[model samples]
Target chain A: MTSGLDVRGITHRYGKKTALNDIGFSLDKGLFCALLGPNGAGKSTLFSILTRLFVPDAGEVMVDGHSLAREPGKALARIGVVFQQPTLDLDLTVRRNLKYFAALHGLAGKDADRRIETSLEQVNMAERAAEKVRALNGGHRRRMEIARALLHGPAVLLLDEPTVGLDAETRSSITGHVHNLASEQGLTVLWATHLVDEVRGSDHLVVLHRGKIHANGNAAEIAGDVSLQTRFLEMTGGGK
Target chain B: MKAALICLVAIVHREALRFVSQRGRFLAAIVRPLVWLIVFAAGFRAALGLSIQPPYQTYITYEIYIVPGLCGMIQLFSGMQSSLSLVYDREMGSMRLLLTSPIPRWWLLFCKLFASTAISIFQVYTFLAIAALTGIGFSPAGYLAILPALIVNGLMLGALGLLLSSTIRQLENFAGVMNFVIFPMFFLSTALYPLWKMAEASTILRDICAFNPFSHGVELIRFALYGQVDWMALLWVLLAFAIFLSGSLWGYDPSRSMVRRKA
Candidate 1:
C-alpha cells in the first residue's frame, strides 16, 4: 500500500554545501510525524522539495501513492501546506482568503462554501470569518492558516515551523489541534520544528541533524529514559 | 476547462480587489499619462509639428499623436507593478501558497498575465476618459475597436513583466530595473514622435524606434483608434508576446528559479 508520504534517497545541495543528504522517511496514514531539526538541519530545504517549489538534485517524493516528480498535479492535490511565514492576504477578509484558496483547488460555489465553513469550524475560526486578516492576532492567524490548509481535505498536511512567533498557549493549542487532526481525521502530518516538547512518546519522530537523519523511530523508543531534548542534543552534538 | 476558467476568474478577482484597495496606484497610472498629455504635449506641440503618417489621415496635434503611446505607457507601468507585486508576494509567502496549489504552473502564470492585462485595460480606459474630458477624443467606433488592441498590447507588456519578475531576485532591484526598462521603452518608441520626424534628427535612432516592439504596439493602438487595422504592427506585437510569454515560463521553471537554487 502507498504510504501517506514517502521520501527515499532525497539529496539536495547548494554548491558544495549539502543541505540534505540521502534523507529517507515515510509516514503511514493517520500518523503524526515530527521532523525535529536544528536551525540549519535542512528543514526548509526538505519542505521546499516536498511542496515541489524546488526540485531536488536527487530522489523521489511519493504523496498518497502519486510520484511528485512524474505526476506533480496529482501528488500536489493530495497534500496541503501551511508555510513557516504568514501567507494570509492581510487586506482581504478571512472568508475571501478561504474562497481564493478553494478556487485554486477547483472548488467553488456551494461546495467551496461548505468546505470553508467546515474547515473554519474545525479550527474554531468560524466566528471570525468576516474579519480582515490584519485584525487578527498572530495565534488567530496561525489557526486560520491551519483552517485554510484543511479546506481541500488532503490526505497529508505539511507545516513548516507553523507556530514560531505565537505565545506559549497558542503554540500548544495549535500543536494539539494538528495532532488531533492526524488522530481524528485520519490525516498524515509531517510537522517540521525543533521544539522537543511538541512530540509525544508515541508519535513518530525523525530527528534530522547536519543534513542527515540521526534517528527515525517512535519518540519513546529513541528517547529511552532521557527526554527528547537531551537525546536530540546528544545526537546532533549541539552543532560542532 | 471549467476549473481553468474558475481559476482565471479568481486570479482576476484578486487582482481587481488589490487594485481597488490601492487607490494610489490607480492615481499614479492615470496621472503619469495626464501629465504627459497636458504639460509635455502642450510644450512639445509647437516645437514638433507632425506630417501625415499612414495611421493618421491628416496632420494632427502632438496631444492627438501621443495618446496611443500614453496608453501603451500605462500598460507598461501597470505590467511592471504587477511584477513588483509578484516579488512582494514571494517575500510575504503568499506566492508559495499559489505555487503549491494543484494547478499547472503555466496556467497560473498565464492567469496572472491575464489579470494584469485586465487591470491595464481598466487604467487605459480611465486615461482615455480623462483625455476625452480635456477635449482629445477618438471616433465613437474607435473606443470599441481599441479593446482587442489593448488586450494584445497589455498581454505583451505583462508577459515582459512576468519574465523580469522571475529573473530579478529582489524587490530592491526592481525599481532600478524599471527605470532601465520603462524610460528606454517609452522614449525610444513612436510614443513621442513619428519615425519620419525622428529620421530628421538621426536615422540610427529612427531605425531603433522602428524596430522596438513597443513602437509597433503603439502603432497598433493608433490604427485601432482610427477604426483601422495595422496588420504588421499586430504581427510584431503578437510575436513579441509569444517570445516574452515563453521566456517567462522558462524563467519560472522550478529548476531555473533562484528560489529553487538557494534551496
Candidate 2:
C-alpha cells in the first residue's frame, strides 16, 4: 500500500539562504507524526512546500502516491492543510466557511452538509456552526478552522502550528482532538510545532534544526530517561 | 466542468456575502460617484457644454454626458476594492485556503474576478436607478444594452486590479497607488469630457487620453448606453483585458510570489 505521505530530497532556498536542506521523511497511514522544530528551524517552510503554496527548489512530495509536481490537484485533494495563521473568513459563519471549503473540494448538496456536521462534531464545534467567526473567541475559531479542513475527508492532514496563541487548556484540547483523529479516524497527521509538550511518547517524532532533521524515532525511545522537552533542547543544542 | 461551476458559485456567493456585510463599502461606492454627479457635474454643467458626439446625437446635459463615466467609476473602484480585500486576504492567511483548493489557480482567480465584476454590476445599476429617480433617465433598452458593456469594462478594470494586487508588496502601498491609478485614469480619459474637448486643450494631452485603455472602456459604455456599438472601443477593452489577465496570471505565479522571494 502507498504511504500516506512520501517526501524525498526536499531542499529549498531563498536566494543564497537555504531554508530546508535535503530533508526527507515518510508517514504511514493512521500514524501521527510530530515535526518538532524551533521558531526558525524551517518548519513553516516545509509546511508551505507540503501545501504547495511554495514550490521547493528541489524535492518530491507524494500524497497518497500522487506526485505533487506532476499532478498537483490530485495530490492536494488527498491532503488537507491548516495554516499556522488563521484562514477563516472572519465575517462568515462557521457553517458558511466549511461549506465553502467543501465546495472547493467538489462536495455539495447533502454530502457537503453531512461532512460539515461530521467534522464539526469531531472537533466538538457542532453547536457553534451558526456563529460568525469574528464572534467566536480565538480557540473556537481555531476549532472551526480544523473542522473546515477535515470536511473533505483527506487521507493526510497537515497542520502548521495549529495551537499557537491559544490558552493552555484550549491548546491541549486541540492537540488531544488531533491525536484522536489519527487513531480513531485512521488519518495520517503531520503536525509542525515548536512546543515540545505537544508531542506524545508513543507518537513518531522528527526533530529538525537549521534545515536538517536531527532525530527521527518514537518519542519515548529517543528521549529515553529524559523528558521530551529536555531531549529536544539537547538535540537542537539549546539545552541548559 | 461540474467542479468548476461549483467552485465559481461558491466563490461568487462568498463575494456577495462580503459585499453585503460591508455596508460602508456599498455606501462609499455609490456616494463617491453621486458627489461627482450631483456636485461636480452640476458645477461643470454650464462650464462644459457637450456638443453632438457620436454617442450623443444632440446637445446633452453634463449629467447625461457623465453617466457612463460614473458607471465606469463604480466598476473601477469596486475592482480596486476587490484588490484591497485580496491583499488583506493574503496577510490574514485566507488566501492560502483559496490557493490550496484542488481547483486550478487560474480558474480560481478568474472566479474572483467574475464575482467582483458581478457585484460591480449590481452597484452600477443601483446608481442608475437612483439617477432615474432623481430626474436623470435614459432609454430602458439602453440600460439593458449597457449590461454587456459594463461587464466588458468591469473585466478589464478588475483584471488590472488583479495584476496590481499580485505585484504590490504591501497593503500600505496600495492606497497611494490606487489614488495614482484612479485619478489619472479618470481625469485623463474621455469620462468627464469628449476627446474633442481634450483635443481643444492640448494635442499632447489628447494623445495621452486617446492612448489610455480606460478611455476605451468609458467610450464602450458610452456607446452602449446610447444603444450604439463602437467596435474599436470594444476591441481595445478586450485587448486590455487579455494583457492585464496575462500579467496578473504571471504576477501570481508561485515562483514569482513575494513570499517565495522573501523566504
Docking quality (DockQ) for each candidate: 0.80, 0.75
lDDT of each: 0.93, 0.90
Compared with the true structure, what per-residue lDDT tens digits does model 1 show for residues B186-244? 89999999888889889999999999999999999999998899999999999999999
lDDT of 2 by residue, A1-240 (tens): 999999899999987889999999999999999999988899988988898887889989999999998899999998889888998888778889898999888788999999998988887888988988889999998888888888888999999999999999999999999999999988999999999999999999999899998998898998999898888888888832
Native contacts recovered by candidate 2, as a share?
A: 0.73
Candidate 1 Cα errors over 4 Å, as ranges: none
10 residues in a row with least lDDT, candidate 2 chain A: A231-240
Clashing pairs in 2: none
lDDT of 2 by residue, B1-263 (tens): 88889999999999999999899999999988899999999999989877886977788899999999999999989998899888888888888898899989899999999999999999999999999988988999999999999999999999999988887767898878668998899899998989899999999999989999899999999899889999999999999999999999987777667557652
Off by over 4 Å in 2: none
Give interface RMSD for all predictions: 1.0, 1.2
